[model samples]
Target: MSHAQHAVPRRHSGDTVVVLALGLAAMVVSMMQTLVVPVLGIIQSDLEVTTANVSWVTTATLLSAAVFTPLLGRFGDQHGKKPTLVGVLLVMIAGSVLAATTTSLTWLIVGRVMQGAATAIFPLALSVLREEIKPEKLHGAMALVSGTLAFGSGLALVGAGLLTQGSDPDYHRVFWLAVALAVMALAGVLFAVPASRTKTGGRTDWLGAFTLAMLLVLLLLPISQGHEWGWTSGRTLGAFVGAIVMAVVWVITESRVKEPMVDMRMFAHRPVLFTNLAGLLLGFAMFTQFIGVSYLVQMPEDVAGYGFGASVLAASVVYLLPTTLVSLVGAQFGGVLVRRLGARVTLAAGACFGVLGFTWLSAAHDATASVIGAGMVIGLAISFGYASMPALIVASVPAHQTGIANGINSISRSVGSAVASAVITSLLASKTIPLPDGMPALPQESQFTLSFTIAGAAFVLVVAVALVGLKAAHAPRTPVLRKVTQSGTPQSAEVEADAELV
Candidate 1:
């Protein structure tokens, strides 16, 4: 038998079940990450801390998630998938328990950091699904997983708001609930996931992993905290310099290593290179839509904002419709879009949708109608964009590197989200404008207006990249020349032609 046939057969049912469960778990965990946003002010008052310090509750989780996701992806690929997943779930449960029991903000932030490690669940789950699912079903399966990530955040926001708004405002209950979910998810993953039959060999590239970690820190740190740290301060400059040096060192070290942590050579392919670059832009652009819209929906009315004071539940319900509806629509139609227009066309269409959505948002005044309408438009646009981008990444990478490649793609999203937050946060904090005597605070409205407008502009840029640069990006397969050794007349010619086709 050939080597390919001799290889172990896929466990399709078990793999699909594990992926479905992981997708659900990832969705819940993602929602849990942001559940505290609506109640930050209340939590601050009770904990007797400044808003600045309270913000750490959110930032800590994001930072940790971004830093560790790629690490987990690499480890999962090197060792085995199920063990890594179990470890990640255990870490999340520990974090939830710590956060639930702690009254101190310090401990809460610490727990959040630990919980952030679970960020790997989404990418890891995708890697596993890609490995085992039939090629025919892969597209829909990935779409489902991606949609869950987007939709879960919206649901969590609403759920957190509802739980925290009750009498006595139980913020701690949110964390406890997350813990319960994690425990159940752990049990499901352990019981349902099949153990790997593939050989688990080779020592992990510790030095390369460390260097890449430093590289990510260098790249993400300055972008995330530059505004708060003073853009021109030593901290920002040092991070920039450190990122440059580490990146260069990383290149040299990875090149020399027998087993590189990340195979940088993957970028040698034009399709892989440009697809990731576009992914980065899409991330930078689409993430801002959520931030701008969420802020608009929650901001009080006197500030020229929607004044929704819409409890978290109400706002989330509104926010979710766009994502959930579009996701379902996208999953159903993604294959048709791919078959008809190709991945490049689909991405461009998504970006166009984002551009129009953001432009419409920019024109809307701070009203419930505007916020909900904008959410619908932006969510639908992102649905097509998110679902297609990962499929393209999978198509471009080899099976063995699936985990690492997708992990990097996930990192692009994280980086983009951080950039959006930094920009929006600065705009909200620093900008000021005069207001009419009876009108709302001009500064607040102006910030939202400008930020949304800029976000629209960012989406337009993404469209430009998709159209101009990504139009022709596809994998380049080498052509192997073959000759027919037979000395027959027409028969020799036919044999040579057939060999070339192979």
Candidate 2:
């Protein structure tokens, strides 16, 4: 191994403190994403909105987050993460304030769009840490950060349930709590985090941004509304056509632009391409697990589900355990695995776990134990792959491009989820076979069994792509293994004359 490939400086006490704060902030923001779920019924009645319209509160946030995450990530890369984070928190605060006062579904959707800015926090924090933290500490920091996206949201559902129980269900309380947390996070980031090393040099890609925005809107509109609109309707068909045309145009325009929003040339790198392919699959498979298993456990027992008739709190708590627990374990073990087995093996292992877990879920439909086991498998699998993909992407790209590269990777994942949620939900809802006299219209066993099967197939497909398509290409010049004497910064070094001899 090259000396530049050596360990990072020993983490100091302050490093731990800062990482914990980042994790906490990320957790809070993530929790806010789903906190409204338990209170949706109340909000619908209060706002005089249909259940479908109220659903947009969540959908708006997700859509905005998907479309803007790459943009925010690039901004962070160009400017500094600290400022970007402060900006994001401010947006969330504004969103909370707006949501708290909202009396209509339209305003609620607007508030959600504002709040969606917080989703950028996860990627921004990771990008910031890639520069500041040692490689040794990166895994743990990232795991906690990523895991927050799961656990924090789950916890938020629980908290929302507890707070909203009985007496009039003051749903606004959820946003108020989120507002408080956002304020605290902003303060902590301002005090604790340092400025980024990156300096914005190039002109902004306004055209590219416009193109991407149009493309995303076209794509997501169809996905989000296809079921409601009738898939074959002119509106859905028109949107689909527009999305295709916009996407193709984007490719051509981005390739020709001086400062493109997405750096298409990066895809020429094998590992980068492979990582992105894996990301798409991972996103589809992993997200489906959440939706599938939740429905499974909460479905009434008579229909062959776990029959928990689980409240939002009970279901979230039960489902979230595996992700929260395994993420910690995955973070600790990932670095060691990288050191010993290499990044590819670690990633592949995670994919394997996904396949196993989802497959079992498809087969084991009638029991709660089966549901719990499936959750554990899926959680462990995602943590492993999620932890490895970022590391691999970082190792491949230039230092300055890490944030942008990862941003696109993040976009890929989001797009995958957007696609799956659209496609899977459409399929699952398409058929409403008559219920048996004793059972619900759609049997719980049939729904989840099919969902899990679809998810498992997606995972297996990704693994196949990774295994068959990805191989080591020419390695990037390795960094100097030793820490810099001047300020203790990490730096790359030239290979020794005899280094290839080893």
Candidate 3:
């Protein structure tokens, strides 16, 4: 038997606990990413920060995620997943405490930075799932875990809305909620997850990690902030150029390193490449639904000539809650699809659902039931995307490379989301409906239609990626060469085992 077999622990009673733990971790990570979205205004007022400074509350977390995700993912591969997971969760807890207790904007940003490091948890959780679950159950297990991410983000919005709905609410309650969830995740990790069974066992590739971090930060920064910086401004354009340059540097550096942080070929391999592309499009679609619907529903209908006139609380609990519930169901169903059909087919179904969902949302969102029903469809699509993308990664990469491979895929989705945010913000801003006096302008009805149409187009791209990119992936083997270690060894056996797992 190869190392991969040995690394997979014999099944036990504790596996369920571990799965629950991993599920919790996935949800918490997703929640942290969006928890503050609905409460930025409250945060600004409470912290007495300017809009730009308040914006960093989100920006800081995104940047920190870019910095830490790759590094810790590599670290988990080198050192130990359990330790890395514990350390990250602890840092997140500390960060949550600081944010909950502090009144200072700088400290809050710092706390957010700390919380952001926990983004590593998702990849690490994936690595654990790869190691601990039996092959027969692996796809469904991963799909289920990935599915949590969908409900998690929506739950964050609803939870935040609820916490702040009271007459006198504290913004700190948000972080407190984060604190409680992180602690629960930590407990699950401590008791349920086994010790790391496989370590790549090598010297850390600090150079590759640094270059990749720089590349991601540079690449994601402008995507996330271009609207604020003015897309045509030198700052925005400069960051894009810098990101491209850094990409070249990082690629070159990875190729030369003795023990590269990532094997470049793993990235270009058809299944991996297309899976990441699908991830990007799905990510964009997910956020497009989120921002587009949230913004659309919240506009005061009586005043703006459109929208549901929903409050923040109503938007989360009423307009968007069904999507959250349906996503969990979709994720379970996605696992069935992956197990019975294939990740490729599962992804195609998701993409098709996305197209249909957005079409529904775009053409007939005038009624409450129509909007809610459309959101559930989109939510189902997102759950399927989450469920299948990682399964594709698992089938392609060796066990030791799981952390970094999934980490890169995770970043791909983040990039998609950042771009979606910028695009949606720009689209909404570009056209405004005429409002009566003393009313802030609302996005014109046509912009929402245009946004949904564009998002549906992105899913159309995913259908191509799923069908074409993953077409022959079911054949004998992954096309990329194995990542060679300093010992000049190739993990051919591991790859064969991985394909079997799929």
Candidate 4:
């Protein structure tokens, strides 16, 4: 009945292949986000750079991803998803090669910036799934893809540990592994994904894109660096002020643009607004487990009075890996829940699990069994939260707007993570037990308690946001248009749809 409906092909046998290919691509790109965490110290030593300079290997990638992801998503919507996806994979491969081959920190940072463009792959892949998969199967496929992202992050840490083992401990090997995976992903996407027929034909919104980039840079730069550069320092404060100013200008620019990069009005839509908020809170809760548990297991028992002093490899394999593996299971369960209940309820349940998990960790983390149990619970929460987000967003927006909408949602999650990293670091560093004259200080046990409590509170807030804000928002609607496009006018469709897919 509508141009979009006619343009969308019926589900075919190849759809499964497409999902697998795109999921692999999403996993590989997600892996790039955390691959360097276990090896940052080694990279600093090898590159002959200060701790501050070496941190840029991760920081640059963060800033770059924040800048590029939304722009690329918008571009994919305007042009074609398959080509854009393939191009992103190619850039990622090149970046991996450059990082693997180079010894210079500057060159490696450059390579990481290139790799950051791959952040768009997840949202673009979702858009493709919407176009290709049967509606019945879409939720499960998206859940699998989303779960793999969390799985790949943990897998990367384990993979990094294995690759960097032995006295030689070659850090370059990590990037080489990334190169191999990217090549595989590139081939899979090129071969399996069909060319996209749906295109939102519009001129690229360069001004809107630039303003948004500046706003994100201003917001993220301080969040990532505030711990290193004193929080009260001029640079950090100036960046915050600049971000506020830039955000205002961005709002004005977006309102005026005929083809805006992100639709400003979407922020007012109850489902979109609250979904983004819940994403931010869940993102914070997720990172608390990631950074908190990793540091907790590694604390020296004699010095800190509460840890196993685990190595990176042991932490990955023993403590964090099991939880990550469980998350895959949780993701599948979440898909079933979304079909049976709805995204809002699924999200609320996940948030409740988060609150429970973190509360348990905060109270009883003395034994390995307790830590593992809490980790698994949080893992389940993370999987369910991640799975429900895309479903909520995809169900809320039109098919054509899926890419950009999810892109903004992704940015919200990133912002939360950046804040979580900064806040948790600040909290842990706030009060430390003094050691012998030459020994470095260790965080007091109470700091970890405070951190977990704060994270649990954030999850509690998510539960409230979902129940009150999202539930009261407008109901979901089908994307069918009332009338087909005529001449140059755009087709109009009801914004409400049947929310139940199960």
RMSD of 2: 5.3
lDDT of 1 by residue, 1-502 (tens): 1112222556677656866787776676566556677778777988999866887887787778767887787777767677888999999999999999999999999999899888888777777776566555666667677777777776666667767866678678888878877888898778877765332246778898788878888877778777768889999999989999998998899899987767776644555666676666666666676666666666666555344655456666776446556654664465456545666677778778777877777887456676667667777667777667767666655444567777777777777777888888788777644556775443466787788788777777777766776654552422211111221112232222222211
Worst 10 residues of 1 by lDDT: 480-489
Score each candidate by Cα lDDT: 0.69, 0.70, 0.84, 0.86
Candidate 3 TM-score to native: 0.94
TM-score of each: 0.87, 0.87, 0.94, 0.95
Tens digit of per-residue lDDT, candidate 3, span 65-89: 8888878888898777999999999
Clashes of each: 1, 8, 0, 4
User: What's the candidate order when arranged by decreasing lDDT?
Assistant: 4, 3, 2, 1
> Lowest summed-lDDT stretch of 10 residues in model 2?
493-502
What would the per-residue lDDT of candidate 2 be over residues 1-502, giving only the tens digit for each residue?
2212332343334666567778777787567666886688888888887866877887787778766777787777666678888898898889889998877778878989999878778778777666666555665666566656556756777778778877678898888888887888888788877666554446667788778878877887777777777889999999999999998998899999977767776655677787888888887886687666665567666544345677666776776556556654665565456445655667777788889988887887567778788778787777777767776676665545566677667767766776677777776675555666875465435665677788888888767755665545225323312222232334442112111111
The residue-level lDDT of candidate 4 at 309 comes to: 97
- Model 4 RMSD in angstroms: 2.6
| lDDT of model 2, residue 364 | 74
Worst lDDT run of 10 residues, candidate 4, spans 489-498
Error (Å) of candidate 1 at residue 448 is: 2.1
List residue ranges in candidate 2 displaced over 4 A. 1-13, 303-306, 433-444, 473-502
Error of 2 at 267 (Å): 4.4
Task: Tell me model 2's lDDT, rounded to 2 decimals.
Answer: 0.70
**RMSD for each of the candidates:** 6.2, 5.3, 2.7, 2.6
Residue-level lDDT of model 4, residues 195-276, one tens digit each, is: 9867776788999999999999999999999999999999999999999999999999999998788888765567888899
The residue ranges of model 1 lying beyond 4 angstroms of the native Cα positions read 1-7, 14-16, 197-200, 303-313, 319-321, 433-444, 477-502
Local lDDT at 195 for model 4: 90
Question: 2 or 3, which is superior by TM-score?
Answer: 3
